[model samples]
Each structure stands twice: as structure tokens, then as C-alpha cells.
Target: MKIKLALIVILFGLLTTQAQDKITVAVGTNSTFIETYNKNSWSGNFTLNKAYRLGPTSLKTLKDGVKTSLKWIELNNSYYKTFQKEVCRFKTMEKESFKFHGYVDEFAEEMTMIFYGESDGSFKIEIKPYNSYSIFITFTNLDMLRGFKDLLDGKSANNEIDDIFKK
Candidate 1:
């Protein structure tokens, strides 16, 4: 009986750790990206910059309006944050009245999402592809910023997109 109880406890602990290890990507929020960008483009108020990081081995070029931007970073071994994800997180930090900061996200693929918080409560988007390359956009626009904020608040705006993230 003692051995059986010990085994059960060990199994439960393993299960919990496994659950935490699985990275959750809010892919369903893809529509929020489209809706917000469709209404307006990124504002010139923000400047784009790339932060040096490691992880992915390749990056993919995608359209951000008329300009070509790095859309996805090939996670030679991991995934990076999408452009919008970075914006929302940065905004959160600013809302908290904190300076711009960065936290390591190893779960991200080669290309990671980056946020640069500003003194006035704005951030720049850096789509760092896998390896050392990155695609810089002008900056997130008003609607895009709002959508991103909504995303961080747990409001996916569009249900169809949000459902995609559901297991």
C-alpha cells in the first residue's frame, strides 16, 4: 500500500509538470491582428528596432501593409512571439508604470517577439527571426494597439480566431 501511494504521487507530479511544459500559443487571436491592422496602419510615433536574441535558425518575410516585414521566424528549435503579442505585453508593462524591460522567453521559436516600452507608454515592435535577422515595422497603429490590449485582457474580439488556440 505504501509503495502504491508513492507511485501515485509521483505520477501526479509528473503530469502537472508536463502540463506546464506545453507552451500555449494564442494563435486564435490572428483575426484581431487583421481587424486592427485593416482599420489603420502602425503609427510613426514609434520607431522599430531589433533586439539581439537567440533561438530560431530562420526567419520568414511577410507583409505589414506595403512594407515587407519578418512575419515568422523559423524555430530551428523554438517559436518566437508574433508582432502583436510583443505590443500587448509592452503596453501592460507601461500601464503598470514600469520602464521598458525584456524577459527571456525560451519557449519562443527561433524568432522571438520583442517589446520596447517608452516613457509615454508606447513600445516598438521587433520581429526577430530565427538566427540574427529581424523585420521591423513602422509601429502598431491605434486599432492594432487596442486589439492587442484587448488580447492581453483575455478578450480575443473575434471568437473564431480564439477557438483555434483551444485544445
Candidate 2:
């Protein structure tokens, strides 16, 4: 009986391990930050931009309407260059601080990107506006998106690097 119990325990552990999908990488600012993600959740440390940055451990490809897609958030140089012009709504440029009031559907040509809050229980998102050349954001797989909204509004982060020198 004891042997059977042990075998069952081992099998359960293996199953649980297999059920999780995870990825971790040290990306931007010379790899000073460690980013990680799994299945429906992600987290990372933020440092000012320098030579390079870190990438997420694992993530799904988040695509815009045009299918311009990106997976992990790192000090990815690709974002620095303006993506070639594609079919879209309008040219949006505004000097606004960190204030995420809604979801992605509310955006127009003025804001360039509109956001709206999801009434149904779904996921959460947090964004870090680094600057013109760099931006950082994270979403949650947890049940609610309330607690972390402040993070998107520039409340607190695990690691906030002083990138005054980057400018």
C-alpha cells in the first residue's frame, strides 16, 4: 500500500509539472532585469535602458489588428524602429502620462490606442511607459484585474531603474 501511495504521488507531481508552461530570460539594460512568464501569468524586474535588456521566460504572441505581433517584453531593439506603415485607423500622438482607464477597443486616431475595462471577469494588465523609445507592460492570468491596475498607472514596480542617463 505504501509503495502504491508513493507511486501515485510521483505521478501526480509529474502531471502537475507537465501542466505548467514557463519561460524565463534576462533581457534589457545589459540583461540587468530578469523576466519570466508561465501559462496565463507573467512578472519581471525593470531597469533603465542601457546596452540591452531581458526577455520574458515564456509568453504567447500578442498581436494587434494588423497581425503585427510580439511575444515577450525585453529591451528589444525591434520596437525602437518604427514599424512600416500598415493598414490602420489614424495617426495617434498625445502627451499623456500613465493612465489606463479602459481596454484596447476605445482607442481612436487621437490617442492612437484606446482602452476599455472588461466587464466580465477575465484578465488583468499593467503597463510601464518607459519613454518614447521604450515601453513595458504585463498582464495577469489571475481571476481579477483590479489589484494590478495601479501598476499600469505608474504606482510601483519590483524594480524601477533610474534611466535619467538614457535621454
Candidate 3:
């Protein structure tokens, strides 16, 4: 009986560890972000843009590893699609003077990226979901920034690929 109990405990521990496993990717483009989630069964909000604003009562705190109801308004979109809400697991990461907040969806299928710097820098990005783990992508290069811009603009990847092949 003790041996059986030990086996069950071991199995439960493995499952718990797996549930908390995180996948981090340094995103360069919307396609990369999309592809990452698609291949991993994660969820994201591709329609998110700069015009969207977080609701006043949404995400009221900045504590790490906390779960909260995320609410925001997509200003550029219509009313039906404007106000968005989701249950998310909040996580934080600090690099240099910047702090990034990741809101992973309830089921851990997607992550919404929000960042603010100590010295007047802030931005947000939405990527599809993943499990109860944090997904943070830090932009450390120009290419990543450019790619992200293209993503926000809804640019076609075909043109980018053609340009690359032409070169």
C-alpha cells in the first residue's frame, strides 16, 4: 500500500510540474508569435493594437503571479468588439529599467503583453494563449521591433518573404 501511495504521489508531482512549464519566445513578427501558439495549442488576441486602452478597473494591481479579470477597450474597433474581458494569470518580469506584465488566459492558451518602463516607455501586444505559464518576449534588436510593427499594421508575410528571396 505504501508503494502504491508513493507511485500516486510521484505521478501527481509530475503533472503539477508540467502544468507550470513555461514557453518563452523572442518574437520577431506576428507570424512567429501566431505560429508559436498554433503549434503549442496556446491562445491570443490578434486584433489588439495601440489604440486599445485598459479599462480603469481592469488589472488594478501589479503583483506577480496573480490571477485577475482583465478588461480593456479597443478604441479602433466597434462597440461589439470594443470592451474585452478575460480571466488571466498575471506574471511580471524585470529587465534593465523596464517591467513587463504578461496576462496569460485562464486556461493558459494565450498571453497578452503589457509593459511599462521606469523612464517613460510603455507598450502592449496580444499573443494567443498557453497554459498557466508566463510568456514574455523582450525586444533586444531592431529586427524584432520592425517585425512587430509590421504585425500591428497587418502587413502580409508574403511580401516580406518575396523581398527576402529577391535579396
Best by lDDT: 1
lDDT of 1 by residue, 64-141 (tens): 211212222222113433333431111111111111233233323333445444434443444434344534223333
By summed lDDT, the worst window of 10 consecutive residues in model 2 runs over 4-13
lDDT of 3: 0.26
> Deviation in angstroms for 10 in model 1?
44
Candidate with the larger lDDT of 1 and 2: 1
Off by over 4 Å in 1: 1-109, 119-121, 136-143, 149-167
Model 2 Cα RMSD, 1 decimal: 20.8
Return the lDDT, model 3, position 47.
Answer: 23
Model 1, TM vs. native: 0.24
The candidate that wins on TM-score is 3
Backbone clash numbers for all candidates listed: 8, 17, 15
lDDT of every model, 2 decimals: 0.27, 0.22, 0.26
